[model samples]
Structure formats: C-alpha cells, structure tokens
Target: MNNLTNVIKERLTKIGKDFNEKEYGFLNTDERLRTPVLITLGGSHAYGTNIETSDMDIRGISMNSADNILLGKDFEQVANEPTDTTIYSFDKMTSLLTNCNPNTIEILGVKPEHILYKSDIGEELIKNKDMFLSLRAVKSFGGYANAQLYRLQQKSLVALTPEQLNAHIVKTLNGMRDMLEMKHDMKGIQVHLKDGEIVVDINVNDYPAESIAGVLNVFNKTLNDYHKNSVRNEKAMNHGKISKHAMHLLRLYMMCEDILLKGEINTYREKEHDLLMDIRNGKYLGEDGRPNKEFFDIVKEYEVKVEYAKKHTYLPMEPDIEKINNFRKRMNLRMVEQITKRR
Candidate 1:
C-alpha cells in the first residue's frame, strides 16, 4: 500500500471508526431485504483527495428480497451514521442511476482496490454502467458543482463585489449550461459590468428547466447570504473548510465536464491530483483565506469546455431505460433464484 493509503486506513482505526462487513448486522436479517452486492470507499478517499483529517465514508448497494421487488415493500436503505456507512437497496440504486445522480453514480466507478466487496451481480452492474450515461448529466453534475459554488459563496468573509458576483454567475452558468437556454432563447449569458452593476444577458430557448431552476435557487441563497453581511463575514473568518469546499467546487466541474465531454466516470482523478491538491491546500486562496478569482478563472475555463461538450457530447439524450430495467430484473432474478435454492 502507498504511504498515504496506510495513513488513511490507520487514521480510521485510530478514530475507532474502522469497520468490517460483520458490523453491518442489518445485512443478516432473516428476510434478506438488504443483501450486500457491492461496497466501496466514498468521498475524499474515493476521489484520491483525502487528507489525514478526512472522514471515512462507506457507500454500497444491497440486493433486496424477491417479495420486496415483486410486492413493492419499502426497503430503501440503511444508514449507519456513526460509521458513515450508507447502503442502498438494489432497486433504490437503479432508480438513482436513472437520474445520473452524482453521489450514487460515482459509487459505480470507484477504483477496484477501493471496492471492499463485490458479488457477481455487483461486477455485472459495473460492466453495464454505460447504460446510465446520458445528457441528464448536464443537469446532474453541473447542479452539484453549482451547489458547491453557492456554499463557498455563502460563507465568504466579505460581501459580494460586482466582480465576485460575475464569477458566481459565470460559474453557475457553467453548471446549468444550455439548460439556461430554455429561459430566453439564451444566445449566451454573460455577466458583465454595465455602469459598475452586474448584468447578465441570457439568450436561450428549450434549455433544461430543472438545471436553470437549480442555478436560480443557488443565486437566491447567495443573495440572501449577502444580506447577512458583517455577521456572516465574521463567521467566515473562523471557517477553514471553505478551501476544501472550493476545491470540491472546482473538482466537480472537472468530473462533470469529463463525463459530458469524454464519456467517462473517472472517479479517482489520478491525472488531476496535483492541481486538486493545490486547491485543497489553499493555493488559490487570497490573503483572506478565501477562494480568489484565480480559482474562479480556472473554473471558468472548465465551464467553457463543458459548454462546448454539451453541444457535441456523445452521450444519449437519456439513459437506456429499457436496458437499465432489464439489468435490474436480471440482477433481482438472480437474487430470487438464490432464495429458491436456499429453500
């Protein structure tokens, strides 16, 4: 194991948060409503950005009983918060994948070594991951990055200047992309100074509505946060994790752009390690220890790239719903067959 990997594993044990499969006793229920299928490292560790202070997150999928599938009983997931473990039912997992949800989607692409356990069905699930790739990613990933950007903006130690406001709009525009095109036949939305006031000209038609709403939601929250003014600024002074949020904000854009542009999941972020670590370590922070324009400049670069990709992306307009349903049935049928043999 690498030194960093050892440190992370050792850190988990030191904090008394280390775990084994046996510790997930919910898996032992008589009905087998949540049988383990796959488990993998999550959060920073899975992304290869974990530091010594990073917390461990274990995420996975579990196969549900035949009755739960056929009869529609409610067995969604079990959350062991103290241990930071979350395992979703196979059905729940498939549903989430249909939307290309970032959190659950990444679980399907974790590095093999990071995957602690996998049954035959789990392997098959990974093999068919491409079925879930679709244009919905334009909304899913960009939305996540926008949410992160909003959080970073919220806890800023100062009020938003016109320039900073421009950055926010641009970053968010990147996240929403052509989705905003629906709003106004958006030729293109760009934040610029008209007499020292931030002005956005949106030109779009038939863009994605949900993604546009997500951008507006974030902007509203940020505007409200600005209203808090000095009180929020003071609180921001003590907030050291803003850098981490900033790093993730940029990283999400990178990941999403890759998904839209290259048609890949890229969970570990091996090639971008140095740049991501620099951001995480505050290389892009200004004297106030807040994310500076330099970081936003980089974010803008990725945003432009993602826009170009959105127009020419090779991914489908939606997931292969029929295929996804078939795979779920196949996995669940194997699950039912297991129960039959046991009987």
Candidate 2:
C-alpha cells in the first residue's frame, strides 16, 4: 500500500483500539424500536488529516422504529394502512429520504473514498447522487465554517505576539488549501517568497504565476488584515486556541462564498479561480512554503528570556532590596535587621 493508504489504516487501527468494545453493541439495540443509520462526519477521515489516535466522528439517524410508532397512526388514518407496509422504520425512511436531499449529496461527495463503513441505508443513499448536495453537503460546509469561527475565537485569548498571530492565520489558510486540494481541484493559491520578495501565486492548470499581481494584492491585504486586526488586535481576544484566527478557515470561507455566488457548492470553482489568476503572471515558487516569518521573529525575540526561564524556572533579574525590606517590616523584622559592630 502507498503512504496515504498506510496512514489511513494506522488511523483506523488507532480508532479501533480506542473504542470501548462494550459500546460497539449499543447501536444494535432495539430500544428505539427502529433501525438506525450511523454517518461518519469530520476528523482525519473527512479532512484527510487522520493521524494515529484519530477518533471517528459519527452521527446516528433512525426512522422506521420511532416514526412508525409516533406517526404511524396518522399514516394509517390517512391511507387506510396498506397491507404491503402500513408502517416503516423511522431510521430506515429518514435514511432513505436523506440520500435524495441536496445537502446529504454534498456530504457524501466529500471524500467518498474515505468511507470506512456503511450499512444497507448507506448503500441506498450512495446510489442516489442527486441528494448528495441538497441534503448532505450544506451541513459539511456549515460544519467547516463553524470550526473556523471556533478556532478564531480560541486564538484571541492566548499570549501570542503579532508574528505568532500571523502564523496562526497562515497555518489556518494552508489547512483550507489542503482541503481544496482534496476536492480534486487542479489549481492552488499560495503565499511564498520568490527571489527575496513575497508573492502570492494563483496557479491554474499547474502553471504558476497566472494572475500574480491580483493574487498578490489579495494575499497582501489578507495578511495585513490578519496582522492588524487578527486575534492579537487586543480588541477581539479569545481565551482559547481558537482565538487565534485560522487562515485555512478564512480560505474555506472564501471558497464557500464563491460556491454561494455560483448558486451551488462546486469544487471546480477553486480550481478555476486558482487557474484564472495563474495565467496572468509567471513567478517562481518559494521554498519555505509556509507563511511563518512572523512566527519565527516572535520566537527569536523571546529566545533569550525563554532560555533563562528554562534554566532558572523564573526571571533572571534579582528582586528589589527596598521591596524586600518593606516586606520584612510587615513581618516584624524591621528591628535588628542590620548590625554595625566594629569587630
């Protein structure tokens, strides 16, 4: 198997090992009086970021058992209860219905190859690609948007410097770019250095520097916004890791906006936009890859102090003698504190 397949297997193995064996049988219980469908949501599976210890995110949907019991009487009263099947499992019915929904279709379309498991309900939905977007996809995008917002909130409360804050945005954007790549988009937008100058490349059809100037302006403005008004702005600080804005989340938001403009979520927009700008300019790709100059600068500033702290577990400077003397006075040590005897 290739490296990617191996990585997936490793993540799966970690999940299997972490799962409580006793809980595995809980889904099969008939306490709900209906069949249930378990759908895998985000994580390494959905994002293709699965490392070891990745937990599988799942959502359960049931129709036949619950719906038939709760709404069956109404159905019977309306249709006179046909003999073939007067009632159906709520889980089964909802599962089937979701397959044809546009939102559902979108969710299914995201890394279908990553599906670890699927029951009969899943198979049925898989066959109906029409519902993939109308029923399933919107929620996926919504979930991503929510995640991004959450991270931005988290990074706002940290002790990060201006450069650290910029790094946070850079990393976030890179994450989103990777997500776009997974959608089979052939183009990419990247911030990198070329011949000692920062340049944003909007590559189209594998050609770098298509619309370099336009892309650079967008990237520069985005970067400036991140530095000036990101979590570090002090006006919008959060108390968690998310307070640090994620550039990837911002990129995802941009992609989503484009999708909304097109009246649908089409992954091709990323590829197309990326390529459109690529044809406008020709520039060499940077080697550093990540936008981390600010992060490194912050690290350098704190290096000396950090080293001192590492060795002493505290600040290097001594305490003020006056402050110590004042504290001693409070402790009744004002008298006999100094003795000047000629010996």
Candidate 3:
C-alpha cells in the first residue's frame, strides 16, 4: 500500500466511530463497520487531475449481511462527511454495474496507488471487471457528457434566452437518440434538426412506441417550459463551474472513445493529463470568462473521434448478456455463502 492508502486506512480505523457520529449523526455497529471489500479515491483524484485545492473523495463497496438482503433491512449505502467517504452495499453496487454506471465502473479501474483498501473479494471483482462493460457505456457516457455540456453552456454565458435553451434541448435530445440507435441497431426512426427545432419520426411497428413517445414528451415539456419563462439571470459567468464542466465534458468523451476503441476504461487518465489539467485551470476560457472558439473546436474534434471509434470498435452491438448473468450469479452465491458463515 502507498502512503495515501495507509493514511486513509489509519484514519478510518482510528477515528471511525467519532467521525461517523460527527458527520452522519449515526453510529455504525462493529459488524457494519468492518472491512470493506473495496475502497478507492474518486472524482478528479481518480482521474489524476487533482489540483492542490481538490478535496479527497473516497468511494467503496462492502458486502451486505444475510439479514440486510434476505430480511429486507434498510442498508444500502454509508456516508461520512468532512472526509467525504461513501460506501455502497454490494447489492446496490451490482445493480449499478448492470446499468454500466460510469462512476461505479471507474471504481473497478482506479490505479493501484489510488486504491485505499481492498480484500480478496475486491481483487476478484477487479480481475473480472471486463464482464461489467457493455454497449450501455455508449448511452451512459454520452448522457453524462451531454449533461456537462449543458451545464457548461448554461453557466458560461451571462444570459440565456428561452430560444437558446430550446435549441440546446433539441440538440441534446437528438444526440441522445443518435447514440441509442448507433449502439442498439434501432431502425425506422429518424431525428432531424431543422431551424433550431427537433423533428422526430418513428415507425411504431419497428420501435417501441412508448420509448419514442417518451422522447417526444420530454421535448414538448422543455419547449413549454421555455415558452413560459423567456429570460434568465444576466449575472457574470461562473468561471470555476465552467472550467469544471469543461474538463469533465472532454474526460467523458475520452473515456467513451477509449472504451469503444480499446475495450477498456483507463480511470487514471495517464495519456490526457496535461490537456485535462489545462481545462480545469481555465486555459480554455477567454478574457470574457467564456469558453473560446478553440474550446468548441476541441469539442467538435472529440465528437468526431467518438463517432469514428463507435463505427470501428471491436465491441459487439450488445454485451454478452449470458456471460454477465452467469458472472453475477456466481458473485451472488459467494455473497450468500459469506453471509451464511457470519450467521
């Protein structure tokens, strides 16, 4: 273990009870506070872009007791403030894994030194990490990127009119639809961008009508909201928020592109360190405190790269569902056995 990991472990063990009381206002029993199967640094630290002011965010997973699962106890996750530590129950983690959640998946890919703690179960989970990756990454990563882009655009500008917000909504929705069709082999559905409006056509027989309708509903609701409220605050741009979102926007693209092209996630971000740090440090912003033209150009470049990676990617159109189901079953059985032994 490295010095950081050692320090984390020492703090958790030495002052765990007091810390929990002060931060969460609840005391964990010894059984509930024992060794976690995995613990790793999260956020910018895991991505290797931490500045001196970055807070240490820790995430972990621990096995749920037999009673907690079978008996339907209320255990799902634990949190302690100040230290910013959070640990999810194994059951909840598995559910998130099935969805290919970007945050949870990164925990399985942190660099060795970033791993503050681990046990045999955690080692096994890391060894079998590939089983959790799937085509779902396209949607998850793209959705996250779109969210960051939305935030960046929203906060970087001094004022945003309803018309502009409507345009952004349409663009985001169409982007989401394109990603879904690219990875899922959907057919007979069309999304069009025209005059700052989104036009979608769906062949009800070829696609789930409800899903298509859901998208339309979201678009309609957003349009209605914009029409209702026409003006927004005209305050100065928030450079810090813009910088943070800008960095994450590129990071999400890089992660998605890597997963598609290389069939793996590199949480340490060893290759994109300098560029990511520059973005975090406001190198991409202009004197007006807004992202410059060069920033948009970089965004366009990554978008094209992600598209290319998607087409040439060796990954299948869908994950090996059978393989993943078998793996999950085995892990569940192991959890059952462990819980039984404790009983």
Which 10-residue span in candidate 2 carries the lowest summed lDDT? 76-85
Off by over 4 Å in 1: 1-34, 157-159, 162-230
Q: Model 3: clashing residue pairs?
A: none
Residue-wise C-alpha lDDT for candidate 2, range 174-284, written one tens digit per residue? 544443443333456775444544445655664344444444454466566555554453444322222123433433443344333332333222443432222112111
What root-mean-square deviation over C-alphas does model 3 reach? Answer: 5.2
What is the descending TM-score order? Answer: 3, 1, 2
TM-score, one value per model? 0.77, 0.34, 0.77
Instruction: Report, for every candidate in turn, its global Cα lDDT versus the true structure.
Output: 0.74, 0.37, 0.72
lDDT of 3 by residue, 197-287 (tens): 6677776465667766666676576555444433341242532677888999999999889888887878888899999989889899888
Model 1 earns a TM-score of 0.77
lDDT of 2 at 185: 35
Order of candidate numbers by lDDT, starting with the best: 1, 3, 2
1-343, model 1: which lDDT tens digit per residue? 1222233355456544465545445445424434577878899989999888887788888887767767876478878787687888889889888877888999987877787667789899888888999988878777777878767776773658657765665565455544444333354555455665545566667778775566567556655655574366657646677778887877777778778888888888998999999998889988877788888899889889888989998898988888899898888889889867887
Please tell me which model should have the higher TM-score, number 1 or number 2.
1
User: How many Å off is the CA of 325 in candidate 2?
Assistant: 81
lDDT of 1: 0.74
Mark the regions of model 3 whose C-alpha exceeds 4 Å error after superposition: 1-7, 11-35, 71-76, 79-83, 157-165, 175-236
Q: What is the alpha-carbon lDDT of model 3 when measured against the actual structure? A: 0.72
